[model samples]
Target: MRIALLSYSTKPRGGVVHTLALAEALAAAGQDVTVWTLGRGGDAGFFRPVDPAVRLRIVPFPDGPAGESVGERILRSIATLREHFDGTGYDIVHAQDCISANAVDSCVRTVHHIDHFTTPELAACHERALTTPYAHVCVSATVADELAAGWGLKAEVIPNGVAYERFADTDPAARDRWRRRLGRYVLTVGGIEPRKGSLDLLEAYALLRERLPGLQLVIAGGETLFDYRDYRTRWETRAAELRVRPLVLGEVPDDDLPALVAAAGAFAFPSVREGFGLAAMEALAAGVPLTVRDLPVLREVFGPAARYAATPEALAAELAAALTGDDPTRRTAGRTLAARHTWAEAARRHLAFYRCLG
Candidate 1:
């Protein structure tokens, strides 16, 4: 099968990581895979290298001002992509986002989020794009249900998989280095966005500090993707008022994340919305016990394997317990669950989906 994976703006983000992993897996499984991505503006490092078996086709476009509408840019990108795919004869064109223009072939669309449906104009855009005759794939059952309820669109749920070997490879020396410098800290891995509930995590950390002194909170990710600087500032002020120290390690590289997760006493994810919690999965794969919000997506992904907390206080309590407890049962359970969700299984499922297109 010849598959074309499309992403209008593929940066070094979770979406891009999913695309790369899927493309590589398909190629390794004896399928011809081609990735269509936008060219990095000026920095070569912005783009990740694809597997040798997978072909890459980059379409260059104007990196315009922030004020330029994303819909207009995506339309232009789709036009460019159509020209590129004119003769390639791809068996299936897998579009990552709802607004992706390359839904030209026997397409499969993945709904990463439903934010566009909130606005009138954007909702119209989504309705138009989603009306395309494509087999839709949702990252979680929660997302699938939302799409079916909101837009009368049914989708298959295909949860993302983590590279177990990469995460399970724990180096005691590297873990010791991080533990020595950072001490026993609760780690949260995600951009400081409102939907991520980072501020909520900060508030929980503040409350936790009142009871358990010297408990450090380490946040690992880049700055907020959206304009939530005021929210971030407010959290910082609240942390300061509560005299809670937070180690804001912004945008750590992918290679260093496993060690970061392994060294942490416990992993925290208080996100209110997520198509799928990739970071939480990574932490679980790294043998780090997780304390996540009692959200549908988290519940679906972790099941009874993870400890759930409803409020910030509950989350803090769970975190504290996981950190101080000597029992390794939860860690063992998380590893076992994560090992079951391998990229090879994901690849086989994806291949089956692609075959359905024909």
Candidate 2:
């Protein structure tokens, strides 16, 4: 089968990660696959190297000047991708996000998460991306239910696949490198975005420090199409008010991320909303203690392998427990769960879905 996988950016965002992984999986299954993406900031390739079997098409996408509105950027992103995307002659065109969905006339779209846009143009684009897709796939059953309840659209639920062995068998020397540099730390992937609950994590970390003063807070991975400077400023202000100092590592090298995950004292995921807790799952794969928000999606994805909290206070308590009271049985179960989700299985399911559509 000939397939084209579409994503908005070449950055290390979750959706982009999914796009590359899925494409490689498909190629490994002996299917011809090509990935299409906008190379923002002159990025000629993905943050990490991809499988040679899967072809890549990186279209140059320059950033808009300073002070560009989020709405304008969204529109420009859609236009830029639309102008460069050539879906013709492909057996399937699978769009991984709203921008890619909006770029094409007909394609299968995977709604990783639903976003509420205030701008009229962006709101319309979001609506169209939700309603116009020929078919839809969601990463979790909770998100699938959201689409069903909100739009009366039924979607296939395909949970994300984790690189189990990569994380589970991290080199001790590499993990030691990160541990040595950061000391004992609570790590959170994804940046200081509102949806990520960055401020909430900081608030919780402040409370956690009352008992665990030796633990530091380390944040990594944040690449997005939208602007979040104002929200980040508020997060910074809150961090200051709470007298918490967090080390924000903008983007960790992909090669070093697994070791980084393995070295953490605990992984914190306080997302207000999520389609699937992929980072949390990776942490589990690494046998790292995890504390995530008590959201339905997270609960569905993480299950008993993780600790859950609904508020900042609760989160602090959970982190404290996870950090100090690590259970060998729970960690074993987490590794087992992570091992069950394989990219090959995901690719088989995707191929079946694509064949059904064809």
Candidate 3:
């Protein structure tokens, strides 16, 4: 089966990671896979190389002032993509975001979030683009439910998977480095975005500081996706005002993430909205016990393996307990659960989906 996977901009973000991994997996399963993405800015080395088995096609889309409205840019890119895919034959064309408007015989669109419903123009564009018959894959039931209720679109739930071997390997140097700075630290991985609940984590850390003097918080990942610099600055100032120490490691490389997770005492994710929390799963796979907020998708993925904390105070209390408590049983359970969600299984599911389209 020849499959064309479409994503306008395939950067090294979570969505791109999912698209690339699935493409590689499908190729490994004896299916011909091609990735279609927009050309990278001046630096071609920005994106990691795709697998040798998978072909890559870059369609040049117009670039203008970064200050231009996103809606206008999206419409322009969609028009360009439609022109590019005019005669390209594919068994299945899988579009990643709501903006991709490429027409194909059998199309599968993955909805990570519903941006269109929030804005009138985007909602109209989304409705127009998605009116064509296409199978929809939602990363979480929450997203699917929201789409069904708001947009009246039906979607299937297919959770994201991680490469187990990547996190399973432990780097002694990383552990030693973290141990040197060590106090009991709660680790949070993601961009400092409102939806990610970074400010909430800061608040929770502030509450934890009074009780635990030696407690530290390490936040990994860079700036917010939507250019919320003011929000991030406010959090930084708030952390200082509360006298809480935060180690902000911005935009870590992929190879370094597993090591960071392995060195942490516990993983903390207080995100309010997420299609799927791959960072939490990676931490779990690395044998770090998780303490996440009560979200449906996370609850379904982590099950009884994780400690649930509702409020900031509750989160702090839970973090303190998890860090101080020695629970090999909990760690074992988390690892066992993480083992079930591997990229190979995700690959097989995608292959089967593609075969069905054929």
Which candidate number has the best TM-score?
A: 2
Global lDDT of each candidate? 0.76, 0.92, 0.75
lDDT string for model 1 (1-358, tens) is 8888886555656777788888898888899888876663533333455678988767665566677564555555566666655435777878886445343544688776666445454566467556674688888888889889987998877888788888889788888988999988889977677777887888788877776788789988753223467877887788788777799898777677789898998899998888888888888888888999999878988886688888988988888888777657777888898888777777898888777766
Candidate 1 ranges beyond 4 A from true positions: 45-48, 66-87, 101-106, 116-126, 223-225
Instruction: Answer with 1 or 2, whichever has the higher TM-score.
Output: 2
Q: Which tens-of-lDDT digit does each residue in 264-315 have in candidate 2?
A: 9999999998999889899999999999999999889888899999999999
* Superior candidate under TM-score, 2 versus 3: 2
Q: lDDT winner among the candidates?
A: 2
Runs in model 3 lying further than 4 Å from the true structure = 43-46, 60-63, 76-87, 101-106, 115-133, 181-184, 223-225
Descending-lDDT candidate ranking: 2, 1, 3
Per-residue lDDT of candidate 3, residues 47-76 (tens digit): 677788998877775465768565666666
TM-scores for every predicted model: 0.88, 0.98, 0.88
Model 3 per-residue lDDT at 333: 88
Instruction: Report the error of model 3 at residue 103, Å.
Output: 8.3
Q: Which is better, 1 or 2, measured by lDDT?
A: 2
Off by over 4 Å in 2: none
